[model samples]
Target: MQDTTDFEVWIEDNEPDGYEEIYTLYRSVAEREDNGIWAVTTNGDKTFVTGPTSTLQLLSEKARRTFLNAVEALKSDPEMDMESWYGYERNMANSKA
Candidate 1:
């Protein structure tokens, strides 16, 4: 293992065609079954990694840079929040309802 001390997990946002932010997460405290959590990022946002630690440890650098945006908006953001950020408002289908 590279001992990233953190991992980024890719998440599919609002189906059809969407992706959530990437995140650089680290091993947090025990949750209960010893399945701690990915609780750390450079941007100050905290969220659950939503997958197994084994998967995270195996993530590639590009994957981490792409998915780790959830917590901390890393420098890799070439657009600088111009078009990178997406939210529920974009899901016009549900909004119309």
Candidate 2:
């Protein structure tokens, strides 16, 4: 079985698709007991499952770039007051709602 570290790298690189594929590769290491939790790290870090595993495979490189940019923005502005990142996302969600 591949480790979590390797799987993380794989996802960042290949971005495999299909629930069965993801489950096969990541289920043992990443599956969470909680209903809302999709994957949890050994260190207890958590990331929500944004969509179906197949959706992840279909994500465009441009979308990945945008996501990385957002992560960079959040990291560069760790002080919440410096950048209301969560607020921006909340507003975006509200607007969509």
Candidate 3:
């Protein structure tokens, strides 16, 4: 596993009114599977996972530690486990077909 302690966070500006600000937490390293990028946002009460995506750069030192902690949590999440290894290969294959 990549070092989750070395990740970064980038917050988005110009967020639409009534919507919480969005942030991008990412890591730059050798790609093993998906690019080390995750989207984060809050619903005025607390932070929540907006999902994952690919990112190139814009690493922020201000949010480094916090984002890295979040990355560690995300990495351990069972929901992010590989479908094939979890016995979803047949269903996935059928869906692809």
Tell me the whole-model lDDT of each prediction, alpha carbons only.
0.31, 0.35, 0.30
RMSD of 3: 13.1
lDDT of 3 by residue, 1-97 (tens): 1212223331222111111111122232111122224343333323333323223231343344455344434332336433222244334446664
TM-score of each: 0.23, 0.26, 0.22
Please name the candidate that would achieve the greatest TM-score relative to the true structure: 2
Model 2, runs deviating above 4 Å: 7-10, 13-35, 41-83
RMSD of each: 10.0, 11.9, 13.1
lDDT per residue (tens digit) for residues 1-97 in model 1: 1233243323222111222222123112111112223333222222223433322332344444444343334334445452333333244336574
Query: Which regions of candidate 3 fall more than 4 Å away from where they truly are?
Result: 1-60, 77-97
For model 3, name the residue pairs that clash. Answer: none
Sort all candidates by TM-score, best to worst. Answer: 2, 1, 3
Cα lDDT of candidate 3 equals 0.30
* Native-structure RMSD, model 2: 11.9
Query: Clashing residue pairs in candidate 2, if any?
Result: none
What's model 2's TM-score?
Answer: 0.26
Runs of candidate 1 with Cα error greater than 4 angstroms are 5-18, 21-37, 41-51, 54-84, 92-97
